[model samples]
Target: MGLSLSRMMAVLTKEFTQLVRDRLTYAMIIGIPIVQLLLFGYAINTDPKHLPTAVLVQDQGQFSRSILGSLQNSEYFRIVHVARSPAEMDKLIERGAVQFAITIPGDFTRRVVRRDKPQILVEADASDPAATGSAVAALSSLPIEGLKHDLKGPLASAAPGPQPFEVVIQRRYNPENITSYNIVPGLVATILTMTLVMMTSLAMTRETERGTMETLLSTPLRPIEVMVGKLTPFVVVGIIQAALIISMARILFGVPMAGGWAALILGLFLFIVGSLALGFLVSTVARNQLQAMQMSFFYFLPSILLSGFLFPFRGMPEWAQWLGTILPVTHMLRVVRGAMLKGVGLAEAAPSLGALALFVVIVAGLAVKQYRTTLD
Candidate 1:
């Protein structure tokens, strides 16, 4: 009675058998740790390199060429676009097309020879400060390294005293580099993603567990009708959550609402629908509430990490970036940040909007198909 080894073994064996039977939970237990290890070890990067840059070199001189070459050799800046004018370069930065823009005035060479200390303008899209920090630091040594070969015995005097040219960095779209400015907008996407998906999945799974789903499914309602009916309330909750977050972002964090409200509203609607649809899909896959929650967490992990919410999106490896791109949260973050910080309009936010719209369609379709299968 005091110590029964046989009884203990029987209970332990039963639990083990149950654990093995629940494949989803088993996978979560084993798979979560390995995924975390791989992502933290290989996918995440703090000091990102090869950032996309645009160049507008008005000066065709030797010194200009030297500076450009130095930038490329630094391995920090990858010159992806050659802009013809200032307007074009600005457009590139605004669209998030380029992280950095280098503009060397036409008189760059003549002024260096005259010791006029010509200024080279470096404009950066500073929305996510962490992404640009290392690259900006690398620019400080460029003046000396860029002009070293061109500055010979005759020009050694000009190079020895101070830098021949000044590198002036213009940090756009969060000039002060406020962390909250970046974090707040991203929170809009993150919060909705976590709550709406988790809630919807749990709600649907609850219906099944309580045996209410059987009664509901017996009705004349179509699969799409059921999905839409279940998801509509959550959509309203998501909207309210978004509004509260945006208001707090403006009032508490002092984040700018620089872009048009139309774009923000459009993005929010698309993202909310997409997130709810994804939740519906998760619910369809899960056999119970616990499994629904586990699946939700699995989805949440990648959405938060790879979506550039916690880290710089471009800072991740190419493969990680590709994975991030598939998540609806990635595009939602872009749309939210673009509208709040960068003043992007519908045209500029088109790509992200389109991506969200597509995600909604695909996920919703899968959810309906899964529900229909259950009906059979």
Candidate 2:
């Protein structure tokens, strides 16, 4: 049946009135794009420089000092950690604490003076090779050039092989430099983040909008019960989401699930709980479904930016990196990547798992408190 012009206009006017009345919706419509613009414009940097580096200096030599100085000057490397021993440095790299490690042999100065090709071993955690590629490349040219400055006169004339020292770059983990190996596992974290947070954020708000919240509250249900009841179903949904992503990652992308299945499953459980708890907390703040959706986006933006998913985590400034640590997704990425890519066990992914568990506890506590307050 053809609708009448007057009736269609009336329906259109009603929708417009509802839209205007919903201030949260209006703000989201206008504010999200502006926020995205600022975030992407200022915060996004693909070619990240000044990656965190660790140094194990056994040589107290002018050549070693010159090499380190040149690395700092290149603006590609920042030596944040000075390890006492090579073993300590390996632990640092294993924990994803440092991107690059420079080991200056005890005889570096003597070798350089004698015109011997002393090898300066540089071990790079090549899990995210793109982040370390430029910095590693800089090491190749910067050290040789810096050595020339110090090795002037007869030393310069006697310098062997055009360069003073050899740089042995050991690209550990994902040596083939496959981009998918880094990205596919990260996709598991990213997809779960967007879906779980957005979906659960709407849970309480939907009940409120439909006027079922009061009815539910009036029942003999405690705040914890209410929160759990709302979240339990979503937990199953999260498991389904994880299953799909993991399966596709294996079959379609050929990303290996090399980590212990127990560790991976446990990490996924903690991460999903934390994400769902975050959504519940968001629901407590938002008065309606629109506000819930908007709040979810607000959290999603920073999570994606600072979580080492899109850009390198070490590439961010100290303040930004600190901010990322507070987000659950940050630890989730670490857990998933460490497990999937490095074949790490529960002990290896312990810190990230602990962080996720902590997040879940804190957020769930807040949600329960807010739920009771709302009930009163």
Candidate 3:
């Protein structure tokens, strides 16, 4: 037994052959690492720049123009909208339409000329503090540098001393910049995505592996009916999990539930159903429980990374953002954060909810088609 090199080599060769024959496993062995490398190396980013900003310029004076020019030059703030009123600017920030908003009061230029220390109100969406941290840090220099060129000759006295004006940065949500406020809400999406997709896929694959699938198909139930019946239990489980996470977020972590429960509940339902539909699609493709698990892992990887649960979604490149947009977890995170932190109503949560609905329809349709194919 000690000297059996030939037999060991023979067994090793047989195992290699078996591995090659399992094409799905072979592909996963090669694909998972490549995906991980590309996502972490190229897609993920921490310091996000070019964040969308809106400006409300009440003073059409030279100083106001100079400050706007300085903001554009900062590269961190990209002026996307010129709001007409304070209400409009507030709406932009509330709806997540803009990350930062700058309001130059009507008397800004006059105050600067009188050395009265004018204030520029800068409102930031601080739901994800990391996304706005650098941009907020960059604002400290704007009061001096923004008006440096304008305060010359007659206004030279204003330039030499303390800052001519003040930039008041109001962090809208999570004013304390609490990390748990962001992470706890996001956990709802991440946890549901991880568990629902894996659980549904494994359950379905288990039926097939145990020969229960053939018995199920022998019954007169249509594919869609069968799919619905199978997914019902997982949906209940997902709801329970979501409720537990949200309760902990409120009671344990002190995460605010700012918006009405109606919006949050509707969004939660849609996201849970959508995730389960995706899992059903994976089960349809997989031949066994192992393959189902691997496929679920593949889905989970991108859902966790690109969906902005761990990293800032806007921090990633355009291509990565586009990839994340298609994921249900991305919209789920938005819906959760918007409701829990931002106090967004049903109207504001509508877009993300619509996206999740579309995902459910598309993935569930594909699952039904694949299940029919299996019947044939």
Candidate 4:
């Protein structure tokens, strides 16, 4: 057919009329860029500061107290817990409750007074090397800087020699400081989230758009069944994405599967289900495909921000951390990282798994309830 200017104008006019009728689409067109601006401008900060730290102070010495003060003043470490024993400190790090654990020796005061090198141990959860790298680097000069006041006069002169105290950093899990070791596992959660949520979130909206939702509702199948059926295909999709990401992580990024296959697989399964359930819940509320897409992006911003994928989970404020706890992404990140890097078993990742199970139950229950039976 020959190109016609009139025909093109007619089609353009039709599209503009349709665009005006779909107010939600217009709102998304205008609002998405503004939201992205705010999200990227205000919410995202990769150089996270004031990471949560724990203290195991075996010495009540002035020098020990000064070191703690310096850590706080550096704005890099926030002492959230004061563990009484090494065992307690281990539990904190293992659970990811604290990013760094500072342990002062009992003889630290005496050794510093005698001009001998006293060692203070700083054990870090190095699973996310970016989270710990800056903090660890800051510790190098802290001992000398902190003791400047106590090292007045004679001790000041001794400053010319080796520092009286040493800050020993024990970077656990990822001692080699591999960035991919942290990023690859997080990619499992990130990929699953983007795919599973976005996929299922459009289920009802797409059906509604195609004018098939009422037909599906007319069937004997319950709302829950329809939701589940629509979600199952996306579950498989999530698994495929996981497999590809995991394979690339191992082959290209040199990421290791430190834990058993079964444990990682189980965690992935639970997390995938939870994400699909969340998407189903979103679909229940969205009136159309555009609204659904917009809502999915709205949920996505927080998932990436508070879920510990881009920044240290503990680095955020207490309220933000608590908010993140409700997100399956946060727990999934912990599970995947622990299993892959820390070589943790299922039991070790039980807390995260349990959280994921709770999220699935709540989200699935809400979705089942939210799905309209009569399509009003």
Which model scores highest in lDDT?
1
The candidates, ranked best first by TM-score, are: 1, 3, 2, 4
lDDT of 1 by residue, 31-88 (tens): 9999899999998888989999999999998889999999999999999999999999
What Cα-based lDDT does every candidate model obtain?
0.92, 0.84, 0.91, 0.83
The Cα RMSD in angstroms, rounded to one decimal, for candidate 3 relative to the true structure is: 1.2
- What's the ranking of the predictions by lDDT, best on top? 1, 3, 2, 4
- Clash pairs, candidate 2, are none
Best by TM-score: 1
Task: Please give, for residues 1-376, the per-residue lDDT of candidate 2 as tens digits.
Answer: 7869999999999999999988878887888798778657766666778878999999988888988898888988889999998889887887788888989999999888897878988898888877887787777696567686788788888888578888999987777777888888888788888998889889778988888888998999998988888889999999998889888888998887766576788989988888888888888778988789888988788888888887888776667779889988888888787777777778777888888888888989999998889888
For candidate 3, the per-residue lDDT at 248 reads: 94
Summarize candidate 3's per-residue lDDT along 1-376 as a digit string, tens digits. Answer: 3979999999999999999999999999999999999999999999888889999999999999999999989988899999999999988898888999999999998888888888999999999998999999999999878988778888977553759999999999889999899999999999998899989999999998999999999999999999899999899999999999999999999999897577789989998898898889899899999999999998889989999888878889999999999999999899999998988888888889899889889998999999999989
Deviation of model 1 at 139, angstroms: 1.1
Q: Write the residue-wise lDDT of candidate 4 on 1-376 in tens digits.
A: 9999999999999999999888877887887788668655655555668988999999997888998999999989999999989999987898778899999999988888777788889999999987887888888888668887788887677654647778888999888998878987898998888878888878767887788877887888887888779888878888899989988988998888786566678889998898898888887778877788888887787888888898877656667778788888998899888878777777777888889889888989888888863455
TM-score against native, each model? 0.98, 0.88, 0.97, 0.85
Worst lDDT 10-window in candidate 4: 38-47
